[model samples]
Target: MLKYKILWFLFNLKASLASYRHEVHELGFQKGKKHLKVERIGYLPQQVNESSGLVYLAQDSTLLTHNDSGGAPYIYQIDLSGKLLNTYPISQAKNVDWEDISADEQGNLYIGDIGNNSHQRRDLCIYQVNKKIDAVLQKIPIHYPEKQTVPDAEAMFVAQGSIYVFTKNLDKSGTDLFVRKIGDNADTLQFKSHINLRTPITGAAINPQKNKFVLISYGKIYYFRIIEHQIDFSNPLYCLNFPHKQTESIAFLDENVVIITNEQGEIYRVCEN
Candidate 1:
């Protein structure tokens, strides 16, 4: 009798999930209805001109950022107000199109050097470092198994013991999401899914609970909820608008609040209304 009841419960749960996914697919991706007012909270020091990636370090109430390729292979530590605190140099890593940053539960950081603008580079990798700026840098190489043209990715986040990368939709066929185990051998990455965002993706951040994943473009932010270990991207709960044109980086200030940074070194915070 107990086994029968468990089977019935699982069946109902699967049915409900299918129903929800279908409903969202029908609704499609719509423009965010929430008009969030972006408040400029601080100005990044001139040293970080192109703040390509951002991650909020909750332990210290600070932010970690790094510039794009052609810049130093260093990460910048800043306060919530965008004031420069210190710079940690990664002597072993090259800035070859360093596009995004992510951190794990152990407070270790990962820098994605997976940006291939020209779509021809053969080498793609990520740099792992400690949060305290004292550990030795480690390099992990990754190859996209099914990609013919080199993939250009600017957004990445570590979740569920794996690191996921969101590729830029330069091909206009929507973005492809890739995932790989954090400690796995430096092997080819597996394709997770194709996110039909209908727009270019620049940055992304996952909330502390791993329940909400937010992706940002130039003018909008799309929110996705995690369901059964998969992202339900059908109908986003919120589509928040960003006032700036060059919003290249995003980090969650909290469960309901987010902070964005532009290429010109301006910081803005938007909260759910």
Candidate 2:
């Protein structure tokens, strides 16, 4: 426990320094009005103490989330009010280090077992499950480019039949974006681009419209405009700062409203002010 505490402290220190550098150097372009209204909605069930991934299922009007690393191989279904509605167990999957969850337009859900904190994991993969969440459809193995050290990642989303992954970038001020088609076979993740956000991205979500996306960090929310279905990293719509702790997952309630969850099982809602 003490080791973890020390590691956490160091991580925060590095993140703070990176943010400071970005502000001091004016590294990127952020436009429009600032500030967001954040409200603590409720707390998740005790059983889901380490909620790491979140996705809104509009079909059932419920939210789905899973544990961080080794808790269980089950997904918990809850409502906007934080009430536990049901639990769906992925009978043939292992939790390993489930970091994020995303869904394609067909209602097919994907689980990212891609957490590589030690930067030495080689069996990283994403699990594709049916919308019913009862069975594993496919295990899509993921790998970094040859000779590239693995980095920890917690943010991922699926859009237009493609999966987008953003690395945590704990040691630097930038995150790399990797892309791969939904049904692609086991192969290396293609390095698409990089963004110097000066903070580790913990969660990601594409709004209902598919023209905009948001990435969440410990104390910041980054809104980006997706032009021509391509993520525009050069300009950010909003970089709203807020007070949050260990925020690990995010999902769009709508195009403007977002729901956030932390490791402590607390839920919060953020909307444009």
State each model's CA lDDT, in order: 0.77, 0.83
State the lDDT at 153 in candidate 2: 90
Off by over 4 Å in 1: 1-37, 232-235
lDDT of 2 by residue, 168-262 (tens): 88765588888888777747888888887767788999999998899888766788878887864654677666446778899998888899998
Q: RMSD to native for every prediction?
A: 12.4, 2.4
* Cα lDDT tens digits for candidate 1, 169-270: 654467788888978985688888776654467798999987888888765577877767785354366554454656779999788788899887899887
- 249, model 2: CA deviation in Å? 0.2
Candidate 2 residue pairs that clash: none
Per-residue lDDT value at 80 in model 1: 79
